[model samples]
Target: MKISSKYLCVILLCIGNTSVFGQSTFGRLKQKATGIAEKVIDKKTDELLEDKSGKKDNTRENPTEKVKKERVKKQNTVYDFQSGSTVLLKEDFLPDVTGQFPMQWYTRSKGEVVEFNDVPGKWLQLYSGTFLSPTVLLKENYTIEFDVIIDFPPNGNYPLPALKIGLYDRGNKGYILSNDYRVKNNVNIILSPYRNELRVKLKSIENNSNKIATENYILPDFTAKLGKPVHIAMDIQKERIRVWIDQEKIFDLPQTVPVSNLLNQLRLELESSNYKNSELGYYISNLCFADGSPDTRSKLLTEGKLESNSILFATNSAKIESDNQGVIKEVAAALKQDNAIRIKVIGHTDSDGTPKQNMALSQKRAESVKRELIEKYGIGENRIETLGKGDTEPVEKNMDPNEKAKNRRVEFVRL
Candidate 1:
């Protein structure tokens, strides 16, 4: 009549009531209970094994997630656009006082030079429906570079303001600050950065007639770049036009401008938006206009020395801007053409810092250029020598910002 504790526990677990199993023998009940427990354990064990093996299969089936991460890591490393050597106009808004319109620029609507808490340097904050232009004469072969910042709250869902940069012919009217000026011929580069998408458009017109050419492109990962400084560069060589946003070349057209049309003005227009200025802000700074693309081969070979402002560097740093590597590539090409040539790479800086600091920075910059030539361009390291002149040997007096920009240059001398 007495039962063991273990069997009694098993009997309670299997049948929950001892009276119901009175007719069955103890041995048969025990065997049936053991089989049921084993089957239930086996079923749960199989489910756990399947769960552990399913993760690998899911990863293999969805490889796009890994590929997307790799693409983002390599997005900013590809750069090829180069700026022009001759400095025409360089404006960092350093001379202009904050909360006032820049004296060197012309704008019809409201805009002022303002400093930001997070961003370095002064920026020209342009309001909506504004036409802003620097007072510089645009030539056929020139380059333009600037930095822009899109300001929007992180939680806001409003669309970004549209931007337009273009070259227009205003005839003999020199630097007119008007919203209704009629442009004879114009080539506009429009940028629309929406919430989830980005659109870039190019439009060219002649004699105020129909558009001659229009091109549009949709850029990826543009919305994530908001609230940061974005560099934009443009190269206009005769009828050919090329535009770059950050490191990506968004537009390249062989014949985008009219041959007969003379473009004399460089303009930046901010299209009207429904949002308030505080909700959607657009800021621009570091506007540089350089004229005449340097003949690198001729200057380095025939003239025996080539000085280039196009091979730009970061502020007081030796790291070269990736977009300015085209100038170095050209130098490498020239050296490759003539295997017997040796050259010295010299670096210079503006008169802003101490002479000792400038000298050290310049030396590092020169060495950086040499390393790029030898490593990236397959040039021999022994054939290139590096030197730094600092601010001692300037091309011009450092009286103004443009003059200082001309002084901060890289020189290649035939040794």
Candidate 2:
């Protein structure tokens, strides 16, 4: 029985409601189709299977071989930061600009709890203009919190214009702050001295940064003041920076700085803001930095009631090229200086590739790091804890492919 090749090809291509044909087992269908086509060809138009040359073509009967499958593992990558355990980039102080302050600090209103009858009016204007952090006061691995009151307009600035805290660099450094406040343009006024508290340690560079997952806490009206302090707190865990405002959180911003702020200069500056009345003033107090935990936010205000868990640091999807030599030096010095300090080398990978492959790659990358610290530098091996988290963690997500690629790298996590 001669079955035309044309019909066989059609069956193979699975065109025209091929769904039903595909449902049949591969072997049974092939045989069924071949048998039916043969019967039809026998009775229908007597077309010869052979060419005009009268030679029978030799075509194979069985189906072609199946496609070969490959695991196709992604590129092997790792990250490490010799960053110190707790790099409290030191102190950040707002110069006292209380006297010449033009804000209407004196509005005859009953004090909420009169320690002083003239508790600064409901508003205070923070010093406006450019005040660089005489020095970088923050490190890549850090938890930061500070208080700023809106003497001028109050917290919710539809586009929180004046309040910005993030990576300050030559270009795009502004990307460091929160987008929640991005909608508020109203500037807060501070009647008293302001303090920027940073509790940071250079952490191991990582791949996936956002923790297992995260959620942000927010308050609608946005403004909170009872002659009390308004808080801005940032907790950076792995790659995500959870934010809170006076026990109530506003929003979260991805960690703009990577495992390391290449510049090693962590700074925060105020936007060019002014007092609503030009004669406002307020106080920013309780500035402190601890190794793990510090009382940053006016925790007392909420009476120990905060919505979300504290987020440590954020992850930056910004693709960057850097060397750990500088960090190595800083960390080496710390290791030498602080006898109680122990350095841990950590590596990270973006959430890409299969779990198995990513795990192996990350681990190898970690060991590679262990060798570098121990061999190249005179660091003790016992102090290092090498751990690799594959694509399970993400510094940043829902970003462009390039950003994901950047996040897919490693970090030097301080243990």
Leading candidate by TM-score: 1
TM-score of 1: 0.53
RMSD, every candidate, angstroms: 12.6, 23.3
How many clashing pairs does model 2 include?
67
Error of 1 at 390 (Å): 35
Computed on alpha carbons, the lDDT of every model, listed in order, comes to: 0.78, 0.40
Worst 10 residues of 1 by lDDT: 171-180
After best superposition, candidate 2 residue 145: deviation in angstroms? 2.0
Taking all chains together, each candidate's TM-score versus the true structure is 0.53, 0.30
Q: Which residue pairs in model 1 clash with each other?
A: none
lDDT of 1 by residue, 4-108 (tens): 467558777656665655655655887876776777677766556564546534434457888877776775456667677788889899999999989877765
